[model samples]
Target: MRQSACINTLIRRRDNASEPKITDSISPKEASPTLSRLGFLVALGFLRLTSVLPLRLLHWIGGGLGWLFAVIPNRSAATTRRNIAACFPALSSAEQESLARQSLKGMVCTGLEMGKAWILPIEGTLAQVTEVEGLAALQAAAKAGEGVILLAPHLGNWEIFGYFVCEGIASNFMYQPPKNPQMDALLRGVRAKSGIQLAPTNRKGVAILLGALQKGELVGVLPDQVPTDEGGVYADFFGESAFTMTLTSRLAQRGTPRVFCGFAQRLPKGKGFKVIVHEADAGIYDKDLGASAAAINRSVERCVRLAPEQYQWEYKRFRRQPDDSEFY
Candidate 1:
């Protein structure tokens, strides 16, 4: 568990309302004809049934699925291998294979956990958090009437982490809709029930985040994502050039909100999750955009190091390389 000093100096500069006055609201998308489709209905029912199972059972099932992923000739396993090999070249072939297998298993576990996240009662979901670390930064930001930017990377169970923040803090988050309209609606309905505002992952979302920060509200962002070409810059990630999102850095330039990186650690044997929060490295606030982006990557890297297998290696994070090389 790592922590950074309080950002009291930045918080002191705020001269605004005693509390954030957010005007924007996101209404959950209602059930439409699309959800009545057979596939969507079946999937919804299956997830609902899965939600009631004990965490340990769900994890056990996930482990079997992970075994299948590692043994089967699948795109996910292939991509995981490629990303892990590129990021950790020093690892021996045997080590890389082991990591890739474990990563696939973690991915399966994350999928199984989604049922608990979306279908369980808010109280029941929050109860799953056995411990929390570095919450004082959130408290200090609130006390000083300054906003907070919670940077939750794609490590451990990010969905759980988002819900945890919404339960405790007044937060707004940027979301990307899933390709399936039915699934997208389901997510919106489930997440909106917690009263956390969500905006599309676009310019409008950025504006909402800015407004939230200006009024001293908490804003959440997944800083490890790859932004569109116009919104990102090339930066060194794990000694390789990765196109990283700049929105976090741009918001950091605002110099008001206290930025923190957080994640939900999946405890072994399904004991529960532990929420860990840490202050962003100072370099993320640097005027140099590239340096700031690299610093952001470094912060995420540190979190990943805690549990490499829990990170989402299946994602094509290094897909858009600086030289346009097809790494995946």
Candidate 2:
């Protein structure tokens, strides 16, 4: 974790570095196919109205929405069922179906809760983190002036987790901007309110993240994302060869930054959330890129196991396979 003289100089420069603005990243030439300015405003207004509701009530509404997803024919429900079945083959058919239904419900709850995560005041939203586990690791890293690569999977309420983590450290999160300019602007404005810097998913963004790490700051990455062929390698995820991002592995190898995987687990009854953190598997730092990617998936699996139903099953995580076969 020791820093070189050059790194120290970069640390000093970071204090005065101007972060990339989200507005500047948007391309005016690109048009949003689904949403207009008026439509975006209406959606924003609805989200703002829902932001004031109690968390418990939001969960209740989400449960109803989830039930609808389970009973109705939809792509999300199908995907959830397929993922659960493939990942948990040991489970009986009945058990897998039950888990899929619950997962659908949890996914709906995640969507409804985003209003609180994005529209509510930062302090108010963080107040819902009733407990935190394994924070000492992150604190120790920060205290020793070491950069950290935090791998946050698509678990319960990741938006809330991002805000909570950035509150205590100079953190940067890499995000893919929405196609809709208006929506992207709104999301950027809310996320930046907590002082977390945003980096796009491009070369410049990668450089920004590298700079942050050199400065001994934390950078967050969604480890489960499916990267382009050149950016990732096929790795074992849930016993299947899934295309996984190697960005975390590459970043971890660059410096002595401690790599950790974490998530905010949603408690039952909309009680609150629990922030959990754990050091990543040792293989994450392997010199072999494929081995490193496998370790990244292993880390994500560990976090998902903490709350299986809360994991995002609707995503086609195993769509790309080693043999170029159709998975979903």
Candidate 3:
């Protein structure tokens, strides 16, 4: 009853709020043709340069950049601190600060390493995964001809995880295109190189995901992203009310697919990454949308706890509060 009431209140607040609905479908900002082309060329050049450097060098550089972010007065740093403090209230202020710094470092490190994941040969990228913790579960589901819905949260290097899964299974990954058309095209080409189908985050995309699941193929969703008000519900995340997406729950209930949560943990000293997969919280399969949304958050929390410092704490995960108050 409490959960139901809370959700109802949240829904009412959202309905009455004046803010425009947030979505990923906004068109790219208008830019001059020449400038857009130049920008794309520069971005492509940077990717090519970074993709060739050793991972150790990239991490070393990223660490310095991340330290700057922690020390400087910036939105990312402030947001990271706020998120860490809220999610881990038991930690001392000093400890929270330290974790915030480390989290920034990890986040930057992952960004710098994206070249390796997206530009390098798929075989080479796969080799960087030194170990995989749970492959049998996925294999078992595939063997049984059951559809699998893998939830990869914003923990660790998710891009690497996507590549690894696409290579290992017949997979369809749901993604929202960037506002930059050139970047979107580049990323779409890079990701589809591994034989994985890319599903846009729209009605067509959802249909694509459903079709893939129905065919007993694997589908991946970034479960931590905030959906528009119409597509989400309020749920408790780390003891705070968070606007959680209902898509995962709807998919689970509608398709009856076997759900799993996983992430790629960046190993220390630039060694490599560890792909860890596990079953999602049992409540994710519950019929109640509120219970299922809460379960989605719980599953993400479980993954984040494995590598708290590596989680993407910089994102404003709790921006939509239950009382319609500002959180960031």
Candidate 4:
């Protein structure tokens, strides 16, 4: 009880004292609501119900509800549908719709697995790494002793991607602060326990990442996330000028040899997932910022295709636009 009080006091102090940074000006007041709190509650309820009935049965129930949501034509869903349609014009309407539904089901399953990640062992969690397609390239990079960067985008099981590295490569990952300090602490505890050292997504975190690279350790990052006003440049992503994070291109350009990408694809029939690691097409760094950003978007799209269901399309990805003059 006393320990809890001390921790709470520390959290309150930190919350009130957090300062803004040049890259991301997210203040304590502007932090998004933590999904972990609600996830925990949902997990708690799931456990209680599962204790009486079969776990598989409840999962099916969640899956069914997930599928139902897949078909709903709300505004946001429509926007996502339209975005996918424009991006992958090759796909027919029925195929795009199918992908959308599959993506929603993947999100629901991902939601249910949140609590599991908190408690599951790296061995069990990584059972989903079905195939390491081009692991030789990653292994080659790791052996070079110059520190490699593993770009894990939101396209698939991003959470699982970090764990795979920590368990298999003993690498470090960067994550931002959660809005709710309590929830952040809970997840930080889980991530640390899983063997991946977690760094804040602020200036200090950048230093830590650099130091890790210097020590010949891999640094995993999700570059598709929106960059802060000052930290990123507005680049065309999927035909929309989204503020793209220039960090990925910069690192790879600065001689982080052996940059590779990977994601955990959600599988069918309520089964497990598949992990796909591939070499990003070489053109993502073609001289100009605009070209490099386009390359980054293309690379993201390729990975997103492997497991479209796990991609979180619900995010306001294209929320902000750059003024006539752009800054990256």
Best by lDDT: 2
| Per-residue lDDT over 7-48 for candidate 3, one digit per residue giving the tens place of the 0 to 100 score | 223333433333333323333342233345555566567677
Q: Residues 7-105, candidate 1: write the lDDT tens digits.
A: 111122221112223212322232223223434555567568777888899789878888999999988899999999989999999999999999888
Q: Using TM-score as the measure, what is the rank order of every candidate, best first?
A: 3, 2, 1, 4
Pitting candidate 1 against candidate 2, the one with the higher TM-score is 2
Clashes (candidate 4): 3
How far residue 259's Cα lies from its native spot in candidate 4, in Å, is 1.0
Q: What are the C-alpha RMSDs, in order, of all predicted structures?
A: 12.1, 10.2, 9.0, 8.8
Candidate 2: C-alpha lDDT: 0.81
lDDT of 2 by residue, 215-244 (tens): 999999988878887999988988888898
The list of candidate 2 runs beyond 4 A from truth reads 1-35
lDDT of each: 0.77, 0.81, 0.80, 0.62
| CA displacement after TM-score superposition, residue 312 of candidate 1 (Å) | 0.4
Residue 89 lDDT in model 2? 96
- Model 4 spans with C-alpha error above 4 angstroms: 1-59, 71-76, 284-287, 322-328
lDDT of 4 by residue, 270-300 (tens): 4555667787757655666656666777778
Clashing pairs in 4: 232-328, 233-327, 233-328
Candidate 4 similarity to native, TM-score: 0.76
Candidate 2 total steric clashes: 0
Residue 106, candidate 2: alpha-carbon lDDT: 87
